[model samples]
Target: MGVQLKSSSLSPTVDHILDSRRHNSCLTLDAVPKFACRVKYLNLLLLSAMPGCCFCEGMALSRLLLLVLVAELAAASSDVGFVFDGFTGEANLSLNGYAEVTSEGLLKLTNFTPEMTGHAFYPSPINFKNATDGRPISFSTTFVFAIVPVYPNMSGHGIAFALAPSKELPGSMPSQYLGLFSKSDNGQASNHVVAVELDTVKSVDFADINANHVGIDVNDLKSVNASPVAYFDSREGVLKSLQLISGEPMQVWVDYDGGEMKLGVMVAPLNKPKPQVPLVSFTINLSSIVLDEMYVGMSAATGAATGCHYILGWSFGLNRDAPPLDLSKLPKLPRQGSPTKRSTEVLAIELTLAAIILLLISTAAVILIIRRRKKFAEMHEDWELEYGPHRFSYKDLYRATKGFDEQNLLGVGGFGRVYKGVLPTSKMEIAVKKISHDSKQGMREFISEIVSMGRLRHRNLVQLLGYCRRQGELLLVYDYITNGSLDR
Candidate 1:
């Protein structure tokens, strides 16, 4: 009834409409002409069969993917830049400013004129420019000051960084505004102040700054109760002085990220790129400051007493914040009794001398042993001749001594065992000594005793009546001593 068409073209149109309806089920198939429906349907089937042909769906999906990608990119960028606070690289700041105090007045800067009054005012402040784009950065400052002739009972003043509303740092403000002037003279007038004080003069037990000491104050410029962080001499005990000494340059750095701030201070030798002194690093929350840009510089003032302070140089970085200090760059230390070349040489000499001494000792021992063997051999030969072999047969001695009966034993000596015996031929009582086969000193001692006694024939001396030498066995016959031995 509605004019149906069944051509091949209409088949495609119909397929198109059908496919569209399947994709979006609310599509109105009735709204399409019959012929166009078939064509639309065919087109839809072809498009559906294709790899990527969903127009509206693809557009919507692409948009969602793009949003996700954008979010990921933003997150990545936020983490891509400088991430830490403190002096990272070789960047540093130097101190070369002037500070003076007088008895009746202090130096003041106003109207292009300099005047001296009892009131102390910083003449020049060390200027530190942030060469970086206007990004909040972290910064720290440290300086050395030496009090002349060191005041014993006086409490010292404080130090400050003046980011004043204006560049013209005038002398009239109270110490509370900027600790450039004495806080004792004026009570907390300057609320826009940040100060770090080294209050050595306030504490009676505090050590002198001139004697390798320093104090650090943060945020409380005028209050005496502001406890300070302190630094003291290293083991070397070298006092740091602020009068532009060769090694007194103070190193300061400011590091800033979007939401973080850090400051660091280091003491370095003049003309050196590396800092050789102790370093202090700190962080501050910068969310409260209204300004995104700031000027960094330092100011100091001496009291009625005479003193001096100095600054060297300053540097800054932008967009890129400072990373944490490597700290490993500080210095290489020495160890006790390190094996230096000199020490090695000394040891070598000592070893050589010791080796020579040992060689001499070993040679002496060998020679002594050789000579002893020769002497022993000579004595043994002489003993062989004098005592004669077959002096006493084994059977004869055994029978005479009653087979070495214990009761027949006369005594003992270091050389051998002695026993009473009666010689069969001479019909005389004699002492017989039987040498032990295994004694370490047996051969030499036996030979010596035999040879010595064999040549002697005295009434007082024991007679070497005769001896037997056979098969590593020895027997000695001597005139008997009735009164025991000489020791007894």
Candidate 2:
């Protein structure tokens, strides 16, 4: 029976050739070569109709023709590969998890949703080994992709271009595994998997080199060869770094030479020519890891943080260089809605300014407290140390007497004004005498007599509690006698 090819963009002439069942006879293997000749003739007609069709690039038409030719050869020979500039007419891709083909023909592997996994693969398996020796065959692939993080410069996990024995990796995990392997299956030789990882997070369990790196993984996430995300500048003769989460489109090229057992990976910004130097190069024998038939695809995963991984174009060829992607024909990336790095810098500046203002306010409050304490400072002398038990702080006295306001005055005698007061700590009522400044001449003798009298204790006489002296004031504390002080 003839293999049916379903494509919406194919001309009626090509469609008739692909769907031979409509002719009431099954096409044999011999007809495939003859069908290829018809396809080449249809390509000339398709090229002439390109101006009338939606596709503006003539190169895109050639790429489509090449993909159909390769798909035919895949049936008869081991050289199997295909190309897709966009997913508009693609119907044979196998999608799982969050993977979807967008209305704009973009193959979105993962979205902003957290803790998700997605996979997109060619529907059929490809021959990866030689029948004679069972040795691995050479292959090349190139893809254009972009990562749009939910936050600038931050994304959870990353994406990987993988080749595995099965398209659906049962029991696989998301996040650090890139949806290819689970914790139990990782690093097992039976997996028979090879992948190129574009990691954005540093996973210690996997011994990742850094947060941003490209690694070549074989049956395990622990890469045998890895490098920081960077590209060589041929003109500058230096290696320049690239940010994978910059929300810009980038191209990656992977090539494996079965003869030399060498694998090379290169990366660069979209529309830029491939770098002369490869980002990661290593010697690896794939014959033991690659199965006879395997599926080729891309897988991605998200952790606590997430970014949308999009594939704009892809091409693969066995025993030949994969066709270059037509950047002009790829879908445009969605404009980033998340805040940029500039906004984060602005927030940092605002926080710093707020901290400075808070510090200034705290310093001013401390200075005000110090000034107020000095206003109520008491005079101290060595002799007063012996009367420490009988002395009261000026601050306490000032607060107790309410600054000696006229309302608290009990009487004005010849010595000074007697004010009704209370002890702050003891909450005991007392009487305070503020001696006139002119009484300073005999203040020492008077204070001595008062101290001596304080030693006297009688129920009928008011008791002396304590005393406080300021630079220009002498204050005496006496026990309070209620009911108008017996004279009022």
Candidate 3:
């Protein structure tokens, strides 16, 4: 597939070059150098034809051609500028010291290891200056990083985004020097280093503004310009302070304009949009500090009080805005040890307590159910089995009479209250009499008399079915007469 751009009569030659690169895939990496040369000569020819029209037209077309060339170069192994969401399986980085690509795909600079210095650089050097005039060109870079200290308030040295002539910086010291320079060569011009530092610990010799600040350094650890870590909130239109050792990820943007010769540094919480105002801005010419060809990389160091420094994602552009990082895809930061561990233990303990409470509630419910079942239990005696005319249980008789309810009452006599009911199982109608007895006489004697009386059945008289004895009440069951009550 190829892209097509509308051709204009303003410049036919420029349109031809654009068409050839888009429709024809022949302008590969090998022909890039030759193609670029041809564009330069064509620019002169266009300007000679029409002075004013060709000047503006040629310049605009040149920018378009430059974007195409840069896009092609970024796809190659040796990129002028690149973007890395993570470092996993990446072969373009040269790492040293404690630097490594973690299993979580983080570019770890300084780990929990103390007194260590680490450096990681792009495999190839980038052309920072113009070929015609040796002046530093405009560049922009942005990265998401984090500084996690062992203690809450304490931290080691810091980290820096550095551009050096060589990939490796020999004889650099850790701690306050920031792995960029030693005490002896602190301000030497021959060092030729331009760096933007995210310093966590202040050094008196370097005249650091505070323990946490972003600084711009050239050929020395002493910052030429520095400001506390903060971002300008466009919505609220105010500045907010940030903590470096809070173990949270933050994003930083460093942009330099060679035309105005201004350098600006800005920082905000991770996933936030870039701030409109820069935290630290200074007027400085990097031409003297940065060489023609320089390696862009990061450097970090740890003193006695160490911490883990990580780079989650990075993007850089030579003369355009760096591509924005996809925050959702970046690797997650490692969990803090002490706080995370304690929280986990507390969660487990809470779950165990809840389970125990649930089990206790379940056991108590079962015991209550068994106790309630026994409360309504029917009383049975072995002696009652001897004399019986189908002795109905207390529970069955109680149910037949609907618990001797007043509503089912047939009549009330001096001996007891008689109630009319139907047997649940046999569907036979009957009348039950409930009489209160407080006698200490033998229960078998009373049951025997009642059983014999129940056997005396006649056609004209009501038949006695059975008798039941409970707590302090004696119940008698008889056939229900549907005609009329004797008293009525």
Best by TM-score: 2
Task: Choose the strongest candidate by lDDT.
Answer: 2
Give per-residue CA lDDT, model 2, range 1-488, as digits (tens).
01112221222344554444334333333343333343454454344433333322466764685467556644345545678877765446899999999888889999989989999988776667765466778889999888877767789778899999988888889888899999999999999999999999999999999999999999999999999988887778878898888878889999999898889999998877898678898888888888767889999999898989989888888777787677788887764323345446777899999999999999999988888878787778776777788888888878788988789889888777889888789898888888756445776676677788899998776788878898888888888887645222
List model 1 lDDT by residue over 1-488, tens digit each.
00111111112245545656466543332343232232344345444443244433564564564456445433322221121112222222222223322221211111111121112212222112221233343333222222221222232233344433223334433222223343332333342333343332332222223422223333333342222233234555544433221112233333333445544444343333434333444454433431322334455444443222222222222334333333323221112113233345677899999999999999999999997654333124453554454256665676677778999888888867788877676667878887656443556566667666777877767667667654555777777778756223
TM-score of every model versus the real structure = 0.29, 0.64, 0.56
Q: Could you tell me the TM-score of candidate 3?
A: 0.56
CA RMSD for every model?
A: 30.1, 10.4, 18.1
Count: clashes, candidate 3: 0
lDDT measured at residue 103 in model 2 versus the true structure, 0 to 100: 83
Worst 10 residues of 2 by lDDT: 1-10
242 Cα displacement, candidate 3 (Å): 0.5
Off by over 4 Å in 1: 1-159, 169-178, 181-190, 196-200, 203-219, 222-259, 268-283, 289-293, 318-488
Per-residue CA lDDT of model 3 for 294-405, tens digit only, reads 8888999999889888898888876667767778878888763243344457778999999999999999999998875664464467876675545777667667778778
Which residue runs does candidate 2 get wrong by more than 4 Å? 1-139, 144-156, 165-168, 174-176, 200-212, 241-249, 256-262, 282-295, 301-340, 343-347, 381-383, 398-427, 433-446, 449-461, 470-475, 486-488
Q: How much does candidate 1 score in TM-score?
A: 0.29
Q: Which of the predicted structures, 1 or 3, would earn the higher lDDT when compared with the native?
A: 3
lDDT of 3 at 405: 85
